[model samples]
Target: VNKEHGAWKCHRCGESGSFPELQRIFGDEPEAAQKEAAARWLVFSNALKVCQDTLLDYPHILKYLRHKRRLDADTIGKYRLGYMDEDFIKQMRAKGYNMNDLREAGLIAEEGNRPTFQGRVIVPYLNRDNIITLRGKKIGGNILQARGVSLGLFGADNVRTHEGDVYICEGEFDTMYLDQLGYPAAGVPGADTFKEEWATWFEGARRIFIVLDADEAGMKGAEKIQGILGNRARIVELPVPEEEDSTDVQEYFIRDGYSLEDFDRLIESYRGTRLFTVEDALVEREELKKAEGLRLGWKDFDHWIHPGILPGQVMVVLAKTGVGKTAWITQVLHNLSEYWIFMDGDHQTQGPGIPILMLSLEQTKAELVERMWRISRLWDPWMTDDHFKLAYRNLRLNDENRIPPEDVRVLIHEFVDDVQMMPKLMVLDYLGYWARSFKGRSRYEQVSDSIMELKALAKEFGVAVIVPHQVSRTGRRGERLELDFARDSGVVEETADFALSLWAPHSKEDRAGGDLGYMERADVRIEILKSRHGGLGRETRMLWAPASLALPAAGERGFKDLIVKEYEWLDRGLLYDDIHKRHRGGGV
Candidate 1:
C-alpha cells in the first residue's frame, strides 16, 4: 500500500489498484477523504513475483522464447519476462492476497483464476520500478493483456538517460533490439498510441527517429505524429531492398551482415518531405499598401529604419558591456509613453505614442520600471515620484516570460486569441540572458529560432521589435570593421531589418575631456551594419547621459550637422533626396 488515493503504477501495462472504494474525496467534505486507507501496491508486486515463480515452473517456456523470439538472456531479465500456470491462483491464495484486490488490479481472471495467461509467457509492465501491468504472449494462442492497465510506453524509462537524439519504436522487440545495438531507443505499444505529454520525456531532444512497421497503419500513424511533433521528427522507413526482409527492422538486423552503420543510413532518410516554391510565397501589393510602422523617436535612429520600423521587421542592438544599449531603449520606451512624436525641428508627426510591451528577460520588473522612471523624470523637469508611478502603469512589462520550444507555438497562439490589440512596440531585452529551457536546441539554435520567431510576431501584429544581442569582443576593439559580430550567430545579422552596433570608448584616450563624467561619454558610435530598407555603412556618434538615460550629446550633434528642416521640399512636393542634394549645393 502506498497512500490514500495513491498507488504504485505499472511500468509497461500501466495498471495498478488495490480495492474498491465506497467513497471518494468529495469537494464538500475533506475529513472522510483523509481517513481513507491508502491504495495497496504490494498486491501487484506479489502478483509479479508469483507470476515469475510460476513461469520458472515451466523452464521449457523460457527455452522456447530464447529460440523462437531470438531474445537473449539479458533481454529477458531486463524486461522481467515470466509465465503463469494454473497453480498460480493457489499461490496467490497461500500468500494471502485478496481475490477481490487481484481482480481489481487485473492480475487474475475476473470470473475464475484458471491462470488467465495459462501456458504463455507473462511480460510484466514496469514503471518507476513497480509492476504497472502485464501482457501474456502465448506460444500458440491469442495475445491476452491485463485489463484496467493502460498500455504505457515500452522503454519509456530510457529517455532520462539520454538527450538530443532518440529512436522511437512501436514495439518492445524493436526498441530492445535497437537498445542492444547501442542506440538510445524507446517504444510505444502501437504507432498511434503516443501521448502528447510524452514529449516532456524528450525535453532537450532535437531529433526523433520514428521506427514503426512499414505498412499503411504504421505510415499513417507516423504521419499523424508528425503533425504533433512538427519538423523535428523524421519517420525512418527501413531501407530494406529484399522482399523477404521488407517488414521490420528487427528481421533486417537479426539476419547478420548488417551493422549499426548501415542502419544509420535508413534512419537518416527523411519521411513526409514537403517543399515550397516562390510562387507560393510572393508578397502581394495589398499587404504593401496597408503597411504601417513605429518610429524610434530620435530622427537619427528613425532614419536608419526609414519612414520607421516597419511591421514584421527586426532591429537588432549589439554592444559591448556598459555601452548604454539598454539605456538607449529605456529612453525610447519613455518617449513612446509620453507622446508619439516631438516637433523640436526633428520630429514633426506629433501625437500620443504607441503602446509598448517590454519582455525584460535580463532585468527585474522593478529595475526596468526604475529605468523608465528615470527617463520620464528627464523629459518632465517637474515630475514627482507619484507621477512616475502613474506613468509606469501604462507600459506593459513582464520579467516572467518564456515559452519552451515545445510549447512556443501553442502558447503564443493562445495569447493571440486573448489579446484584443497587440502593442505597437515589443522589446525582448538581452536575448542570451533569457532563462528558457533549451529543448534539445544548442545555444546557437535557440538564438536563431528566437530571432526568426520575433520577426514573425512583429509582422503579424504590425509591431516594431528591438532585441538586444551580444557581440564578439573582436567586433568592439574600437577599430571600425564590417564583420559578423553577433555572438554565436549569423542569424542575428541575417534576420534583422537593421543592425545597430554601439561602441563606447573603452580606451582611456577617447573618454578623456568629455563633459558628462567618463562613464556618461561612452563616446558611443552607432553603426548601421545591415539595413534592408536604408543604405548600409551609415554611422553616427553619440554621448550617453546616465541620469537621463539618453544619447543627448549625439542627438544635438546630428541635429545641428545633418537634420534637414527644409519644409520647401514638402511644399513643392519634391523628394527629400532631391531637396537635400540642392540644399547641400546651397541652391535650395
Candidate 2:
C-alpha cells in the first residue's frame, strides 16, 4: 500500500484509514476514488458551522434571500445567510474554479441571465455528505428577478448529520427556516422535482418530515416524495394564512413567526402513515359502519327501496333530459322529512332525518325549492307550512363559492351532527358539474376517482349516496335508455351498487308521424340494469306527472303490478315498436 494512501481521512465519519483498509470496506480503486470524492464533498467544516449558526438565528431571511438583497438582523441570525457579491465570485474564480464549473455547480449564469444572484443572501444546497452542491439566492422584495441555479438535497445534507428525525423541505430557505426553530432539516432546489437517489439515501432515517409549499404543485411534489419514501415519510401540509399567495415553510416562519412547539403540533397533526395493506383500511370501514344508522324519517322510500341503503352502499340514478331524476330524489327527501317528523312528533324539532346531503350542482336553491313545493302540493297538500321548514334547514351545495369535495363532506357532516342524526343519504345531482382536481388525467381516472371518493364518503359516513349521471351519446337512440349508456360506463357501472336508467316512451303521435315527428310522452321506464344485493334487468314503468314531478299511484297497483302493465302494453304493441324491438333484441 502507498504510504500517502495509508493516511487517508474519511470525510464523512472523520476517521482515518489505510488504503488497504479502505479497499476492504469500499471495494477497489474506482469505488475507493468515488467514495473519497463523495467524502470530500461531505465535510462539515467551519463554513457549514457558520451557515448553521446563522440559520438558527434568522430563519425569515430565507424568503427574501432567494432573489433579493434586503436583509435584517432576524434574517441574518436565523438563516446563517451570507451575501454572494461580485467580490465573492472574483475570489472563487481566482481559486482556479472555471466559469463552466461555476455554471455546472449552479452558481453563475450567462448575460440575459448573467448572474443576477448578486447582492442576494445565499443558502447552500448540500448533498447527504454535507458538501454544498447548489445554492439558492433570496431577493428581499417582490420585484421579479432571476436567481442562480438551485442545488442541494434539500434538508438531507444538513439534517443527516443529526441523530433524530429529519424534516425535508422544498427550498434551502425553508430548510433554514426550520433550522431556526432548532429542527434538523434540508431542502431541494425545486418544489416540483425529487431525485430518485434521495429515496435510498433517506432510508436510514427513522422518520422523514416533508414541509412543502401550500399550493397544488407543492402538494403533488409531496405526494411524489411520499410515494418514493413509502412508510418512512410524514407530510406537513401547512396552509398559508389569509391574504398570502405563497405558503412555503420559510414564508410561514417569516410571516407567522411560529414557535417550535407550534411546528411540532403541525407536524403531529399532518403526520400520516403509509397504508400498505388491506388491514389498514378497516378502521375507515368500521367508522362508516357506525355512521350507517338511519335517522328515522323516510317511511315511504323505506317501504319501496327495500333493505334501504344499508351502511356503505352507493346508488346511482340516471335519466334522460326532463325525465324527473331530480323529482325522484326530491320524493326520497320528502319521505325522509316525514320520517324525521314521525320520529320527533314535530317537523320543526325533527333532526335532519338520516342527514340528507343534497349536492344539486345543476340547480339553484330557488329551483330546488320550487320542485319541493310541487312535490308537497301533490303528495302532502296539508303540509305546506312544514315544507317551508324542510326546505330552509336542508343542506344545499350551490350556496358556496367553492364546491370542493372536502367542503361537500364538511357541510354534510355539520348538518348531520347539528341534527344529532347520522346522514342516511347524499344526493349528488348531475355528477358532471362537480369540479375535479385531476383535470389533465384520462376521463376514466377522473370519473373513477370521483366515484370512488363519493363511495368512500358513503362508506365512511354510513349513508346511501345517490349520484345522477347523464347518458353518453355513443349508444343507439332507443338503447340509450340502457345502463351501458351512462357516462363513463365502465367505472360508473363498476362503482355503483344499484344502477337505474330512466327513459320516456314515444307518444301516440310519434308512431303515426314517423321517427322525425314523434313527440316524447310523459311515460317513464326504469330499468334496473345492475344490482349488487338484488335481482338485475328488472323493468318498471309509471305515468310520470310532470306538474307534480312524480309517478302517479297506479290506483292501488303495487310495484310488480306496474311492471306487469308495462309488459302488457309492450305485448299489445301499444308502446313504441322500435324501442320494444330493441328491448327484445337486447333481452331486456
lDDT of each: 0.62, 0.55
TM-score of each: 0.49, 0.51
Q: Write the per-residue lDDT of candidate 1 for residues 74-191, one digit (tens) a residue.
A: 8777878777777777888898866776666566666665556667787766766776667777776545566534456677777645766887887776777777677787887666
Model 1 residue runs over 4 Å out of place are 1-228, 231-283, 339-352, 384-394, 401-419, 440-442, 456-463, 475-477, 481-483, 506-522, 556-588
Candidate 1 TM-score versus the reference: 0.49
Residue lDDT tens for model 2, 282-351: 8765764555344223343233445456667787888765567777777666555542211122233333
Native-to-model Cα distance after best TM-score fit, residue 452 in candidate 2, in Å: 3.6
Candidate 2 least-lDDT 10 residues = 142-151
